[model samples]
Every structure is written in structure tokens, then in C-alpha cells.
Target: MTQGLSTPRLAALASAPPRPAPPPGEAVERCELCAEPVRDGHRHLLDLEEGEPLCACGACAVLFDGQAAGGRHYRLVPDRRRELAGFHLDGPLWAGLGVPVDLAFFSVSGTGEVTARYPSPAGALHAAVHAASWRRLAEVNPVLAELRPDVEALVVHRARGAAEHWILPIDDCFRLTALLREHWTGFTGGEAVWRHIDAFFTELKRPGRPPRR
Candidate 1:
């Protein structure tokens, strides 16, 4: 199915995959749900009511993978980053969306509202997104139809002569935002920040295909 990109999608970024194993002096972060010992590569859970991701151990993440028994509580954020090579978008369409940044994320909220956000030195910044534009894109992309409500997102990037798109877990979106926050400098993000962002998309387009949807 064809995918389209224009502006940010609604959903908060996630608890980043922890950095590489810590040194002996640093403390490790344990699972907030079960207090189980967790490694840096552990997964995350989306707290629907809170609209944030909680670090979770493997067992707890799996146990709550499905919908909560009482009501919508935690939704396990799946880890998949698919390159949408067939995405559709053009100058006029993108201009209509009106996102201020080159890279942004889109997700659906618990209330089924579509939202958009972009990375910034101050962290991710939210902006107004016309729902009609989003609906039009979804109408064209069957893969985007696969985005799990509140847990997955459509990330669109346009900069430095590159056009990249992905269907990624919400957590990865936050990780991207954090990377920008830590590296951004000067008005146009300088050379260092662009370098990192370039390398990031380079890897995203690397040989390894994301797991089948």
C-alpha cells in the first residue's frame, strides 16, 4: 500500500531504549512495573491515561501486551521500524500540513484525535495539524493503517536532500527527539546535529529490513 507524508502524527515519544550498558559506577534502571532487573535493551509500555511510556521488564511487557482486563491501561509498545519506500507526498501537500520542522511524528490519542509533534532542542514541540490532511494520507497508505493506536507512529523526515519515512514505535520517536535536544546548535542545527540526523536515517535505510508488519 502507498504511504504519504506531509506533517507530524499524534502520539508522545517513548522511553528510549536505554543507552549501552552502564559503567560500574552508574546505576541501572529497573522495570517500573515489576521491579525486575532490566537491561539497557528492555522494552516499554504505554500508559493510556498518562500518555507516556513506562520502562518495563520482558515479562511484564509481554503480560500486558494485550488490552487491560478492567479497561485500557497499558499497551506494550512494539519495536518495529519499517521504511515506507512507497510513501506519497509533494511540495503543495507538505505545505498544506504546515509542520515547522523537517522531522516530525504522528499518532492517534486515546480519544482518537490525531496529533503532530516535531523534535527541538527544547524537546519535542507540538503543533496544530489539520485532521483532513492526515485522513487523506491514511486513505492512500495501507501500511499506515497498521499503526497501533497510541503505541505506534508515522515519522516523516525531509532534509539535506533526503526524504525518509518510517512506521515506528512511539518510543523511537522520543529517542529521535532526545537526540535532537542533545545535539542541536545554532539556527539550522549546525553541522553536528545534521550529521547525527543523517547518520540516523542512513541506518534506517540500511540493509536490515524491519520485521514484517
Candidate 2:
């Protein structure tokens, strides 16, 4: 009877959703936009309408820099990565957002609407935030008020009585989401996932000039 009971549990586990794939190998390649050969360090552009990321040579990325171009299809992903020092969200404010996860990314959409997404065991889970909440957040950090629509995000992670906030490119947000979906295990993401998260933050916190406030 023990073996019979275990068989059903195994079958249920087999039907669960698959995890996100690991990060791809890093090698120089052609630009997705101009087809010009680009190095692994080439800049990226975000196709706002389609919500797709495009690898681009520097020249191609420059072409889409100005938002006033009015095409509404493509937006250049800004390279500015910033750490918001002394950022805090009280418990009541956190509860208002309704995100169960401790990490989340917030970005403005093509239509000038702010949205928040958190990584989950299944995939990126989006939670619609009220406009008033966004306004309040902007009041605290005006830099966040200037986040490029669809192409950039303000990522915040609150855990263990500490919080870290970064203004990051949208693609990086997706990368983190992929990481969580792949290696997360049990309630606390297991050992492997925590290691990966730590390494990622180390890169973000490297010694360099902070982004302009």
C-alpha cells in the first residue's frame, strides 16, 4: 500500500509545469536588428509593442534613443543601473501591493501604465498596482519616475529586515525571473538558488560610480 500511494504522488509531480531554461552561452554574434556582427557586450533594445528584447549594435541602439520619435514600437534599453540607497517600504505599504513574493519588478507599459511582476514557481506573475501606489513610490524616488516605458524597470527585493532596490533594464528582470523559475526549490529556493541570487547581486553591486540621482 505504501508503494501504491507513492506511485500516484510521482505521477502528479510529473505533470507539473517545467522550469525556465538556464542562461545561454556567451559568444559574439550578429545583431538581431542590423545583422551586423556584434560582440557579446552589445547593447539591447526592447520592442515595447511586442514585449520582445532585441540584441543590437551600438549604432542600432542609438537610433531608438529618443522617445519623441513617436513610432511607439521600439525603445532603447537604458544602460543605467542604480542602487537606491535608504529605500524602505512599510508593512502596510507592502501589503497593499498584494505580491506574495519578496522580489518584484515595476515598469511602465507602452500606454504609460505602471505594472509590477514577481517571479513564481510557474513563471512571472503580474500584479496590477493602483495608480496611487505608483505615485507614492515616485514621490520618494523621482529617478524612478523617469523609468523608460517597457524597456526599464525598478526592481526591489525585501527580505530578512533589509531591502535592496535597483533601477535595471527590463531584460535583466526577465533573466532574474528565469533564474528563479529554474533553480527554486521548496519554500526558500534551496541552496543552489540562493547562491545564484547572491552572485547576481554581487555583479549589480560592483565597485563603480553610482547612477545619477
Candidate 3:
């Protein structure tokens, strides 16, 4: 017959490696401040100088929300989503931007420069955007003129002879890029990506009256 194990031996056996914890839900997709490991609904901040996306938690995001901070490197990403229905762009001007696709997003870079980019098979591709043209576009839509440099973007979609514009957060632009990169198929991005894109735009709320030209 086997003897019973002592209390100390049982205690030692219980100290073996514990089971690994399961991954977090959608909210834990990436950290909003560091882009590390945050929940899907995690907050985010803007890197002003680098124009980079930062993953942050609620506390970290709150730290940079006040004017006394002098608006340093980090700024909390705002949740304002508005659609600019009256915004207009002619075909020639759109062609001049050189974006391969009809859909593109423009934002001020970390260096205090404006840039326009679009999703492609390879990744997000930058287009050559003349400042004068941007100014012209901004004339009709002054809300776009107020876009927080680097952290906000002006998204434009032109297809089937119609165009739509929206002022969105930079993180939203990244989300769109990530979606296209994952679901894109064929040269036109196929139906799956189109459906996803449609759903995203549908949620945007229209802005107030268009600003004077």
C-alpha cells in the first residue's frame, strides 16, 4: 500500500505552472496610448510631433486634455464624427492629387505638413497633394481647416461621379486601412471590402451648415 503524501509535498505540487489566461476580448485589441495591448474599445492619444498613433488607457488620455499642458506630444483622440455633404471636388483636381483609388484620407503630418493617402494592395499609399488644391478644398469646408494637425484627417470618397467628404480622427483612418488591407480583393477591392467600407461611412453624422467659401 502507498503511504499518504505529506502536507508539504502536496503544497509543492500545487505550486506548479498555472494555466495560461485566455486572450482579452475585442476591447483588448491594442493599447490606445502605446499600441501595445489594449481592449478593443480602449482610448487613444495623438503623437503631435511624430504624427504617430499612440495607444492609451483612460487615465493616460485624460492627462493631456487640458490647455495648461501646452498641447505636448500626446493628445486624447476625440470622438467627434461628422459628415461634410456639401464638400465638392472636380475630377481634374481629384486626378491631380494622384491617389490611385477613389477613396483617400488627408491629414497634417507630424512635421506640420499635409499629406493624402489611400489604401492599396500593398498598404496605405501616399499621394502628392498640392497645398493650393487643399486650400481650395478647405475653402468650401472650413471645418476641415480646423482639423487638429496630425491627429485628425479629412476622408474623401469619390465614386460613380459622386463624391463625399468627412472629417475623421487619424485613428479612424488607420482602422479603414487595416480593414482594406485585410479584406481587399482584386483591383477594385471586391465586394467584401466595399460592404465594409459602406458600413463605416454610413455611421458618420452630418456636420452643421457648410462654412462659407
On lDDT, the leading prediction is: 1
Better of 1 and 3 by lDDT: 1
lDDT of 2 by residue, 74-128 (tens): 7777777878887667776677666777888888886767778875655446767
Report the C-alpha displacement of residue 98, candidate 2, in angstroms. Answer: 1.9
Best by TM-score: 1
Clashes of 2: 0
TM-score of each: 0.79, 0.78, 0.71
Q: Write the per-residue lDDT of candidate 1 for residues 1-213, one digit (tens) a residue.
A: 112212221222222343565686454767888787776667888777766678888888778767553158788888777889889867766776667677878887656677777765444577656778877777777777788788888888887677888888887776676667667786677798889788777777677632110
Q: CA lDDT of each candidate?
A: 0.70, 0.68, 0.64
Which regions of candidate 3 fall more than 4 Å away from where they truly are?
Answer: 1-40, 48-51, 66-72, 160-162, 205-213
Clashes of each: 8, 0, 17
Write candidate 3's Cα lDDT for 1-213 as tens digits: 112212332233234343344465434345545455554345567666665556676666667665334266676776666677667677766776666678888887545567877766654577557778777766765776678766778888775443668888777776676666667787778888888777667655435421110
Question: Model 3, residue 97: displacement in angstroms?
Answer: 2.4
Candidate 1 global TM-score: 0.79
Candidate 3, RMSD to the unseen true structure: 15.8
Worst 10 residues of 1 by lDDT: 1-10
